[model samples]
Target: MKKETQIGYRVSAICGAVALAFAGLHAMPAQAHGKNDVKHVLLISFDGLHEQDVARCIGSNACPNLALLAKSGVTYTNAHTPHLSDSFPGLAALLTGGSPKSAGLFYDVSYDRTLYAPLDSTCTGAQGWNVVFDETTGIDAKGGGPLINLDGGGAFNPDAIPYAKVGGVCTPVYPHNYIKTNTVFEVVKEHIRGSRTAWADKHAWGYDWVNGPSGKGVDDLARTEINSIDPKTGTYYLDTYTHTEVFDNIHVQALINEIDGLDSTGKTSAAVPTVFGTNFQTLSVAQKSPVADNGGYLDADFTPGPQVAAAITYLDGALGRVVSELKQRNLYSSTLIIVTAKHGQSPTDHTKLVKNGDTLTKLLEASNYLDSSGNFGQNNTTTGNLNDGSGLSGTGFVQTDDVGLIWLRDQSQKDAVVKTLKANLGCTAPGICADGPQAYILHGERLEHWFGDPANGRTPDIIVQPNPGVIYTSSKSKDEEHGGNAPDDSHLGLVVSFPGLHHGGRTDDRYVYTTQVAPTILSALDLDPDLLHSVQVEGTRTLPGLGIEHEHSQDRD
Candidate 1:
């Protein structure tokens, strides 16, 4: 039997088990809300927002709208993303109610065992791995062409794409069909009648992916590719402006259209979605800008630079517009607003910037582990010749940000690789080693503890933990990067608000993972969180102190 066919049978068996489990379960009665009660959830994420940035802007005119929301809601001061915080796994945690361990997502470009390399036809290995839908895939080579046809709503050629367990089918998978678990959107749609969900994200591919394998979770998905540099004009002018704030306004308009019973494309007669929201990118852009006084921080204080301050103010105004639109449509008091971030930017202090540093890549190259054909940092390598499997086959591939995830072609070379990395990248300085600015190596059991075991095929063989500001890019474009266990990267801003909550306007200092956002949304809608596969699989609980509780009657097991 073919691997694809075997995977299909295995999936059918799992579905049978799930159906048998559901046969013994009964749907919980919906909690009746009074007139003027919360009936909708508007979940908004400000990508790369730090908790301190919110603190610094609160009570100031720069972020009056966010301050108002915080004043009317419960703010979680110590909320965090997962330890291996990349945008893919970060948002996966938010939507799937589990970390990468349960959700089976590591990053946008990650490794897999039971998959073939779509770009490399000559690949032959027991474990095939390659980049998913990143830049190197040539999906967007025409600079937002049919391969990236979020605007035209066209699907990619499945034959030329890698396969994954999406929508219960192990066929070729698109970016929107990669997640292995059900999302809150899928749960709400399945259980709730007359419920509609809409979302806008940095890429059209992002929110669609969050809708999970079924592809029927969200009713409206708006695509605004933030990173697309136009092929003709060589600018990002189609979806962005000189500032990300101007770019985010496009999403703001889409949200308003959704509120006004219209789709993101200005289609009239669209139903107002029950759950709808979008993410903002201004703060993230500000944090990475090289221009002086444009970044998110100036000194020890959280005071943003001039451009950043303006971006915050503009974002506040955008929030005010959303609130005003809700009130105009009589939807304000009855709607739950969630203000949080997908991930946080690292090195809030500009003085911590490290540049022209490709230390880890050089070390791997010296050890003959890195493939000589492809470029290391940005994903603009030659097509067809790219390594179709993990570094263990011919040469290895290394993905580096503040942290380094190394995939080796030969597992037998693990010891030599670790020894070489420790000798070169490991830090021994006293204060730096104690966490100020240091490097740590994780392999064997330690790596498995934080990230899942590499034997599972998704986890990397080795992880290079550099100090807080040690980015492994030689490019001078951006000052800071993420995807590390550093405090600046993991710590995030989280606020939840709804009418009639007891702890409104209060601050909660308890540590919470962003994964709690998924189950919490299910609980708010009076639905069982266990409907989401990962919530049940991982035993993920709702956010603490949500005030509203549900009967744990569903037989998720």
Candidate 2:
């Protein structure tokens, strides 16, 4: 959908929130000294989870742990991710309370017109540059495969970082610097005295952004790396359904360790995080793997396939472990457990699947639009294998999954590119394309309304939201993908659970965005939500129906 119409969703979300603002006024938890007793906030992002997934699992009693949590929580049946549901933007929405337009992050690997390449330390002829800091940005890749270091080779190599102009001087832009907004971690640490923070995720290298712009948001950020090869078995942790489960376990163990007042490794003593969590990858992998071994669903309804069912069972067990630990420490009543997702998988119906081998790029290259690399994706072989970052290497930088993100070799050629792209909406050769619905292209004012103008760096010149089930991929390794405006891609499951919740299991259908999580976390800790940089700029609202009195956040519409 064009951002023009896509933004209407946010307008509606505000209306829903306002209508339900006082619906749960009587359900406020027993306050302590005019504030909530919540000392910790555990945010679990089961990446690629849907609101229907929670409903189906809860109705069928498949996820008892989640159901129990829901029993004492407010289930926001209409929660959603931002327009571009890539993992980076998805997480940014949660941590910054800012949409991409304000946050200045579109995708994990995007392009910018103002920055220079990493190697251009001297800022020679500084101009546009491609930005890529994904798993490829690590330093310990073994023969172009799994990484060797569990910490993703420690900090990022200088050669892979981008150079941005700070105070009119070229400086290396680390992952944390890439974000234009402050994070919840920063607010918690700076405003709340003696508060420590930690986080765990699949990668250890690129996620330094979790530390926020100051570079000290998270104190004990975990160093666990899921992309690393197991030294003993030589098996890649993400190669199979079973292997992915092992990766999720590592993150879960880290969270459990944090709950026990220890570091992620469980060897060092550290303060429990004031605001900390991890993103689960098992379900995401299962949804992408082959339908045979890691099937997503058995029917168009939310019925889980064998593999998906197994993944959900494992996630619920992991959640149970976390809850058990909280109860053991008598922290359950004072901790707010938020279960949500970064984004949701697309095309739940396998019959509607569409796989056209990178049609958008094919169309662009056919018309002679080329970046430094001859094609799309990160192909900078000059930087060591681990430094394979996505950037201006390709023609105008094109990253396509369910949606197409085009940065264009020449911004002046945008009209011509749109003419060519619109001409070839039909499925081209190579893979299946079940004709189901039409796609929309966003450019000019329609695109700029949601993201900023393309004249500035970072925002893509054009965006393509393909017909519901279409994914631009020639590979046969996976069935579903995210990173788009598809229905399933943006519609997410969100829950705010605590033992003190009075109106437990209350299903709140008010539309909400995950960006609201940042302010809600601060409010739960009895801190001013205004302390968040983006919260002040975006006027981000807290989750309604949670009657916890928030400081200076009610002004948000």
Q: Report backbone clashes per prediction.
A: 7, 6
lDDT of each: 0.66, 0.77
List, residue by residue over 1-557, the lDDT tens digit for candidate 1: 11110000112334445544654352211122342255678998888888887877884656877877776677889999877778878888888888877777777766665564553333443334554544323334322243333342333333225654434444555565567788887787777678788888776443457778887888887755665554455556333224466558878999888888788777676877777888888877777776453555676566777756776777778889998898899887778888888888877777776654666766676667765544442233333323222223223457778788787767778999877765554433211121344557779997786667777666788877777776777666677778877888899988887655533566777889998888777666656677788878777777764433323323221
Model 2, span 182-249: residue lDDT tens: 99898888877788898888777777888889988999888767878877679878887678888888
Superposed Cα deviation of residue 8, candidate 1 (Å): 38
Runs of candidate 1 exceeding 4 Å displacement: 1-36, 119-127, 135-153, 157-160, 164-170, 229-234, 237-241, 291-293, 372-395, 426-438, 552-557
Clashing pairs in 1: 391-396, 391-408, 391-409, 392-408, 392-409, 392-410, 393-409
Task: Work out the TM-score per prediction.
Answer: 0.83, 0.90
Q: Which residue segments of model 2 deviate by more than 4 Å?
A: 1-34, 142-146, 371-377, 383-395, 429-438, 550-557
